[model samples]
Target chain A: MTLSPEELKNFLIELIRTAETRLPVDVYEALKQAYEVEDNPIAKQHLGAILRNSELAAKLGKPICQDTGTPVFYAEMGADFPLRSEFYDIAREAVREATKLVPLRPNAVDPFKKKNTGDNTGRFVPWFEVEIVPGSDLKVTFVAKGGGSEAPSTLRMGLPIRGVRNVWETVLQAIVEAGPKPCPPVIVGVGVAALSDQAMALAKRAALLRPIGDRHPDPEIARLEEEMLKAVNELGIGVHGFGGKVTALDLHIEYAHRHPATYAVAVATNCWAMRRATGYITSEGKWEIISKHITG
Target chain B: MTNVYHLRTPLSEKDVRKLRVGDTVYLSGLIFTARDAAHRKILDLINHGEKLPFDPRGLAVYHVGPVVRRKNGEWEVIAAGPTTSARLEPVEHEFIAKTGVRMIIGKGGMGAKTAEACKKYGAVYAVFTGGAAVLAAQAIKRVVDVYWLDELGIPEAVWLFEVEEFGPLTVTIDATGKNLYDEILERAKRKAQEILSRLS
Candidate 1:
């Protein structure tokens, strides 16, 4: 049976609602682990409250955090997938519906007009990044980025010889400077690319898309993730900047082959809420919401 | 060292004065919402000596744009969490001096001006965990009133809310003009320098 457009729109709506109202399994587990391991009274109490707040949010089916987030989707579709052409329109409709149905806070503002669009959609809203790959199914990942966390986004350019140190400086500085603002115990995403915009996008995806504990496939990159995570936690920015052992839940790095002339680095973070969902529709029309997290 | 305080609105200087950085405070009473737009609007009204739609004296103001819905002709708060507080640092001291608001509740850290204002005006700057919207909504017992919804939009509107047990808020800037974030972040910056030195 062919997958209907209505079905796809409705599925995206579910995905958006799931992302906004519920914490994913991986993120929830990481937070639970953080809470269990924390020793400082200030950090412990704050983490406990975060856990409690998340529980209440899921129980009430409310958006995990008020900034329900700017809607961004990453789609990997098979060349043979039937809905490739319709994905954009379908997502726009879905986001518009979800903005009201999930009751997302209107986040899209016309920069020049300085007015909120009322709906979450504006010129390029519910942004989608698509990849046509070899497969028979379509997988879409939705990330809802909050404004508070987005405020700390950083981008810098330096000589290629300085790439390694630049990466280190940019990521660490962003996190430290953010202190308790981007919401502590954040997930830091660092992107290195030839171009500034590409670096920024990659950094955002790394910070917001990757699972909390999942390491990059490249062992070298994975080691970098582990190293940064350690150094970040050691900074003692703590939960809500109260000063503790855990400042960031995890650190991730994503990079593209850079030009010989330049090294552009970008850094971003996601608040502890980790609002995102991944779903796929098989050629046979079977759908699954694969993002992990379950309430205990 | 951490202490816990439960304070009701129309707070006296003594109420917040007793609060120190790292102390937790729970507020029960009226607090208003104001982001960049609303704060500027309030400042403009204050400068012109025009009456504010709602009184701010002795109460708290939140830096947030909550997710709300209208049901049965009433506003329902779906999620309400603190936004970054640093954005308001430039004008917050003036806001404090003019309004006499005893509490400034938000996340992130405010600058020296806010700290001095807290000291001068007998108020404190507290942090409500960022992204804990549902918890904030639970504390909101009712949407008491709203202003400038048309001009500033939902996110920027001045929303007066009646709340109870509304905290777990940690004082980052105390009435003594001490700032927890500055200390914590400064130490972290130094430690980071140490680590970065070793790593390189």
Candidate 2:
């Protein structure tokens, strides 16, 4: 039985609900660790509050944050998927339905016209990114990107001769200068690529996609991640920048083979409330929520 | 040592003067939410010498754009956590002076300008937990009124709320002008340098 468009929309709605109300287990565990390691009273109290807040949101079926965030969907689909053509419309309708059902804040607004869409859907909103893979199933990931965290995002373009050093400095300055704005205990995603937007997109994916402790597959990249995480923690900006032992819950670095002449580094930061989840649908119409959530 | 103070709205200089940076505060009474747009409007009203929509003197201004809905002709608050406070740094000093709100509640501490205003105006800047919307919503008892709903929309509009024990707010900037985050961040910059030197 092939999954109907209605079924796909339902799955997407569930995906948005999960992203809104629940904290992924990995993210929760990382926060718990941050709370445990912090000697600062303010950081500890704030982390404690965040943990309680997460539990409350889950229990009450309420969004974890007021800033419900921009709806971002990343799809990895099989080339032969039957529902590929209607996927975009299905996703958009799902967001509109989820906005009313989940009671999401209407976040989409026209920059020039200064008018809210009343629904979260608007031109190019609920940003969809797709990559065709070599499978017969469809998988979708939803990330709720908050405005406060996005406020501190950075892009630094520099020459490639001092590429590694520049990337390091850029990340450091981004976090240090970010101060408390991005919300501490942040996930720092760093991307280095030939082009600016590509670097930013990669950085956002790294910040929003990977679990907190997940390291890159490449040893060199993994080592860079580890070093950045260590250095970030030393910055003294603990949970909500209260100044404590844990600054960033995790630091992620993703890079593409860059142009020899130009090196572009982008930083995307997510708050402790990293709201994301994945759903997979088989061609046979079977579907399941894949992301583990913080239950207790 | 951490001191916990429970404060109520329509506060005074004495009420705020007792506060110090890092002290925990649980605020009660009315708190009206505002962000960049609302701040600008409030400042504009003050500059124009116009009668405000509501009496703001001795109240608290929350830095938030909450998610709310209406059911059965009553407002229902869903998620209402603090927004970034630093964004209002440019006009906050004048806001405090003109409005006389004793407590400014938000997250991510404000800058020197806000801190100076807090010192000068007998006000305190406190941080409600960032992104703890559901938890924050639980403390808010009722939506008292609303302003600029049509013009600024929900998030940017002035949402007057009646909150009860609405915090685990950390007083980051106090009436006496001491700012906790300023000191904390200053120390952290030294560590950033150390990490960079070690990296080199």
Candidate 3:
């Protein structure tokens, strides 16, 4: 019962479309909370506009943002899955098709050649990061990482002796420098301990994967997230950098064990759109697409 | 005092200079889109002593890269949202003065030079809601024309759009040289210091 390429392509298109047009449940809820709690009139207006934009995009089944962003997929495959060899090509085909059907903005550009692939497909694009799980099914999540938010993400390397405080300061500096450019109230994801690229990727995953207000299981990490959120909101950068009390809707932290002498901190932020969707498929091509906002 | 104004494009000094920080503006009429690549091309054209593809005076230039789809043989805007303006900060002052565009639409703030250019050249910078691409597209009445679609590609092409009430744009940098983003940065820096110090 191997999944056919046509079936996989169709599922991927649906996944991309859902990710583009709708906000996830946690993101939507946090925005509503921010709108409710915002004290500044200007910030309130910006939040209202964001809510309105979300509403209209949902209604029209159109893209929530103009910059549909870079489509990033994280896949978990059962070790026993039969279609592993064909999955990559099928996914690429889906991205090209989705560019036309879902009308995702063609964002891939050749750095040296200055060429636009036009269909949102290019070398190493619709980027995939895969893991093998024990289950006998495939699970994939799509996150449309918009450029404005990604622009302000940063990584700071510190001496291990500087510890968590330095990481905190770096996060604060990143947010302060980012100001209102990444769009607020932004979700801040902090990755500590891992080196460079892995740290950055972990930071992005923390930003994109974790649900708003979902505290980490570890008490220290949870406390840091809470403090980070409070500190960011106090900066008064507000929505659209206009100044407000709800600058950051949520802050998440993920960490990995690192070398004793070096500490690397990565900070990644996501815009309020927070576009993502999840899908599950089996060898027999039984597809289940579940998006929190769409369903709830 | 912040006032909401209905600004029709092909703006004037009087029209733009009077705008202040935090004023809400609804822009109707014609506007053009240009990103970094298109800006480079337009500036190159000017440097080469060639005529611009379109008139820039009194018109608003949006720093955007839109997603457009072909519908019924016509270009339909799927989502047209503002991109970060800081990427164009180096060239913006020159671009604004040379082109004589009265309004610059983008998100995130530009630099002091751009603010100075706004003051010196009778131009203003406004921020459209970032990530509101689909909502912004609703205001675009039609795609009037496009330039450099092939040479520059879709996102980099200069797209001329006929828009009606195309914004909930907040004037962040005004003709008098005041900038909301800069003011916020100062406050944010002070506030950040306070937070960092207390945390330490």
Question: What are the Cα lDDT values of the candidates?
Answer: 0.89, 0.90, 0.88
Over B14-127, each residue of candidate 3 has an lDDT whose tens digit, in order, gives 999889999999999999999998989999889899998789899999999998988899999988889999999999999997899999999988999999999999999999
Q: What TM-scores do the predictions have?
A: 0.97, 0.98, 0.98
> Tens-digit lDDT track for model 3 on A1-296?
67787888799889998989888878988899989988777778778888888988888888899889898999998887768878888888888888888788899988889788888878888799899999778899999899999999899887788678878789889999998789888999998865788789889989998888889999988988897888888888889898878888899999989878778899999999898999888888889886686432
Model 3: DockQ score: 0.80
* Runs in model 3 lying further than 4 Å from the true structure: none
What is candidate 1's TM-score for chain A? 0.96
TM-scores of chain B alone in all candidate structures, in the order given: 0.98, 0.98, 0.98
Best candidate, lDDT:
2
Q: Show pairs that collide, candidate 2.
A: none
The docking category that best describes candidate 3 is high
- Which portions of model 1 show Cα errors greater than 4 Å? none
Question: Weakest 10 consecutive residues, lDDT, candidate 3 chain B?
Answer: B191-200
Instruction: State which candidate, 1 or 2, has the greater lDDT.
Output: 2
Per-residue CA lDDT of model 1 for B63-144, tens digit only, reads: 9999889999999988899988899989999999998899999988799999999999899999898888999899999999
A172-284: candidate 1 lDDT, tens digit per residue: 88888888888888989999999999999999889988888889999999999999899899899998888888888898899999989989999998989888999998777
